[model samples]
Target chain A: MPPRIAQIRLVSSHPQVYAPCDDSFALVDALLADRTKLLDHHPSICMEIGSGSGYVITSLALILGSESKNAHYFATDLNPHATEVTRQTLEAHGVHAELLTTNIASGLEKRLSGMVDLMVINPPYVPTPEDEVGSSGLSSAWAGGENGRSVIDKILPVADNLLSEKGWLYMLFLADNDPLQICLQMRDKGFGAKIIVQRSTEEETLHVIKFWRDPDIQIEGNEAVSGGKTAPQRGFDFLRSQISRLSFRETRQ
Target chain B: MRLLTHNMLASNIKGVTNGFPLRIEPEKIIEKPVDFNPDFLKNMFSKIDWKALADASKIMGYAELPDEVPEQTVVESDEFLRKFHHALLEVHLEEGALVCPETGRRFPVNKGIPNMLLHEDEV
Candidate 1:
């Protein structure tokens, strides 16, 4: 019998490519939790922005299974080595995705805009020197620079442009990335976001947040009048409490 | 390089806008039989650019696809779906160059892998 998700041995690797780690597992766990919604959504096209070792995307393909016959999968990475590793990984799993070695789907805009039904990203979210943001090899995989928001910031607008009317986006961010502010920014773009999975290790706290287009949220301004005022207030309070809980956990450790 | 993969590729040179459906000039092509999944083909019908796929198939020497997808509700036709599956998945380019339709830049394909890396000046 085949595994329900990607087996660790099947995930290919290269010296330069970032292998699957705690954050990657967290992202996969979030997808598993939302598998029911994803199946019902019936996405025609699914894409992953920064595929490293092809773990998350391949896992997603397996999770969807043959039920999603109509879905097309694509993945892109800045590192050429990562794409190669991803190809090997997918081949090992008997799954397939169109792999491209490009900078965050650069040439894809004209064709893919407003057509992608789902997008997933695990960006470089570790704060480092600004100059180190796009450095070579493995460093590029983790260096986010300035609160780890540089790459995440660039991805948001691109996601906004590429996502279909009913598209759903799942992304992982660190506590230092200031996820609450990121949620507000996406809110301004007519996206409703919720924290799907939260995990704190000794070194970092990872938050896997899912964003979907909300028409009511789009019409309402920063006042948060769309889902009624109470919902917005509750969201803010939840974020605040999560931040404090994460900080408290760290300090106690 | 599978045609399905080729269908999504576009040359990302510095100033090329219409770099879609990159021309496939195959030096060596191989055919390996893969299990036919009818539902997958049916799902892919609407997403594929039929004209571009027909052109690609014609170039790769498997011109079974029509200029436009048949209007006779062919999605349920096993014969049609098998042809679509063979053209999209089984045909492989072991060695080739994907020429940019707009800029004429040639990206080499070696060992079933495409090298889409660009130089700093080219980008």
Candidate 2:
């Protein structure tokens, strides 16, 4: 039987392209963990931003299999080499994605707006000097610039723009990027977010957060007030309460 | 480029709006047979811009697709599915230029890859 996810042996690589790493594997695992729901969702247009070595997108296509045949796959990267490597990876697996070497889906936005049913990203989330972000070649793959929010911040709005009403976004984040804050920002845009998977490596805490449009949340945005505060402010309150709840659970454990 | 990909692409030159159905001036269009998978085709049908697909395919010199997308009833028809499959996935533009509908900018395709990068001034 063919592997459900990309076989590491068949995954193509480049010295300049970011290869499959812990974060990449985690992103695929998150998709695998959610595979049943994903297959049921029957996404029509699926895309990956910053495809890197194409492992995550290839895994996604393989996971969905021929079950969702109508689904079209797309992937974009700023580095030209990464796009080449991604093409090789997808071809090896007998899966294919329209690969573009461009900044985040720049040329794709207008036509793709509100059309992507599923979008996944493993962005450059490491906090670095603001100047380091979007640099040439391989460095651009990891440089997040200033709490790593620079690229993440830019991507959030674009994702919002491109996502269809039923679209879902899965993205990886680091602790330093203040993922909770990122959730609040998404909340303001009428998206509800949940951490799908969380892992702590020796140097970093990584979270794969999934965002979906919540009708209740969207309706509540205009009218939701908790103790005379808006939804965003309420998100902060919810954050504090959540942290406390986690600490309480830890203590009991 | 696959029609599926072309369906999602637009000419994003700084001020170009309405960049749909970029003209495919194919120097070479390779038809590679892939395994037939009807389930995938059915699901993708809803996402496809059928008008664009038909128009683009016609320009590429193969009008295998219908003028209008048949009803979902045709999903079970293997003949219909294969043509849809061929246009969507099999036909590949090994060498071509995707001309921006609005800006007239031509993005070159080399070795089956379309270069969408823009110049600094364009950005």
The model with the greatest TM-score is 1
Residue B99 error, candidate 2, Å? 1.4
Compose the digit string of candidate 1's lDDT tens values, residues A1-253: 5437888998999999999999999999999999989999889789999898899999998988787766778888888888889889988999877777777887676667788899999999999989999765888788999999998898898999999999999999998998888888887787888889999987899999999888666444556434555554566577768767876887788
The runs of at least 3 residues in candidate 2 whose Cα sits more than 4 Å from the true structure, single-residue gaps closed, are A1-3, A219-221, A225-253, B35-47, B66-81
Q: What TM-score would every model get versus the actual structure?
A: 0.88, 0.87
Each prediction's DockQ against the real complex: 0.42, 0.53
lDDT of each: 0.84, 0.84
In angstroms, give how far residue A92 of model 1 lies from its true place.
2.3
Q: How much is the lDDT of residue A212 in candidate 1?
A: 89
lDDT tens digits, residues A169-221, model 2?
99998877877778877887888777788776766778898898876564433
State residue A183's C-alpha deviation in candidate 2, in Å: 0.4
